[model samples]
Each structure stands twice: as structure tokens, then as C-alpha cells.
Target: MRGTLLFDGRCGFCTRSRDLLARVDRHHRVETVPYQHPGTPDRYGLTEQQLARAVWWIDEAGTPRASAAEAANYALSAALGTTLPLRFYRLPGIRWLQEALYRWVSNNRQRLPGTTPWCEREPGTCG
Candidate 1:
């Protein structure tokens, strides 16, 4: 199944994360695109502010998955062709914890690795 991972292209941290995903994605089913790409956001029904806040996963059916942790799990599962992580993501309590962690990281992404001053100054316009 084909899918797209939408992210802020200008964010150093986000770009690096994309790179890591590319490297680990053995199935190559996921395509990473900057939200600023022409018509990308509109095609996926996403907004600049939403893309700036978190990563998104759009499936082959064009269904959007907006939760950061869920997106990651789905992408990784597609790459590995295994449902273990997906099962874990669906587990009670664990999903909530992962969501909280994802939110914390997304909220403070500028302070994370690969971030630059531009990430803090003009979030959605980097690329």
C-alpha cells in the first residue's frame, strides 16, 4: 500500500526524521513530502498550521491519519510488514502514553536535534 508522510520541510529535526525513516523503511511504501510542496496540503486536506504542529500520514485511500504516534507506527509497520508495533500502538494505556510523548516532542521540536533558528522563527516557511 502506498502512503505519504507530510512534514515541515524547513525543520531540520523534521527533515532528519524523514531521512531516518527513509533509511529504515525497507518496504519503501512511504513517501515523505514537505507540506509546502505545490498542492500537497490541499490534496491531503491539511493546513499550514496543522503541518507545522505535527507530522501526518495519508494512506493510499487518501484517508488522513493525524496523530503523530499513530502515523509513525503505521509507517513503520508498512516498512516492516509486521503488525507487532501496530498492535502495541492499539494497546490500552500505551497508546495514550505514546500520544503524550509525541505531542511533547512535536511541541518542543525546535529544541530537538537538527533544529535551526529558522525553525523557531518561521516554522511553516522553511523550505
Candidate 2:
């Protein structure tokens, strides 16, 4: 399946992570684009600030998903050429916890890799 990755290009950390992913992703199933690219916000139905806050993924079929932690898992599974985890993401109980955990990380991702000062504006609010 083909997918597009929307990311923050201005942030050094974000650029490095995307570069790493590009290096590991040999099949090129995933394509990266800066969230601030022209028409990106309109295309993704997100504000520039929101795009900066997390990663966005759009499947070839047009389904869009966004969240930092989940994006990590998605990229890992895709690079590894496995769909087992993706399948797991569909389970009810696990799905809830996964989303909750992802939300927690997304809310605090400034403390993780590739984060910027803009990510720490408020506990749950993006700058």
C-alpha cells in the first residue's frame, strides 16, 4: 500500500527523523511532505500548528490518520514489511489503550525526539 507522510520540515529533529525513515524505507511505499507545503493544510484539513504537533499519514485509498506515537508504529511496521501490528491496532481493547497511550505521548512529544518549543505551549494545546 502507498502512503504519504506529512511532517514538520523546519525542525531539525523532524528533518533528521524523516531522513532516517527515508534511509530505512527501501520500497518507497511511504512518501514524505512538509506539513507547511503549499495546500498541505487544505489537503489534510489541518492547521499548520496542528500539522507541526504530530505526524499525519494518508493511505492511498484516502484514509487519513494522525498521531505521533502511532505514526512511529506505522512506519516501523511498514519498513519491516509486516502488517501484524496493524492488525493488532484494529482490536477493540488494544485499540483503545493504543490510542490513549498515543495521545499521552502526542501531548508530551516535546520531551521526545524531534520536538520543538512550539510543542510545549500548553499541556494539551498545540502552539
lDDT of 2 by residue, 15-125 (tens): 667778888788887887777667888877777777767887777765667456566557656765787667777677877888787677556655667634222322232
> Which candidate leads the pack in lDDT?
1
List, in order, the clash count of every candidate structure: 0, 0
- Positional deviation of residue 79's Cα in model 2 after best superposition, in angstroms: 2.7
* Poorly placed runs, candidate 1 (over 4 Å): 115-127
Best by TM-score: 1
lDDT of 1 by residue, 18-41 (tens): 778888787788887777777876
TM-score of 1: 0.84
**Could you tell me which residue pairs clash in candidate 2?**
none
Q: Model 1: which residue pairs collide?
A: none
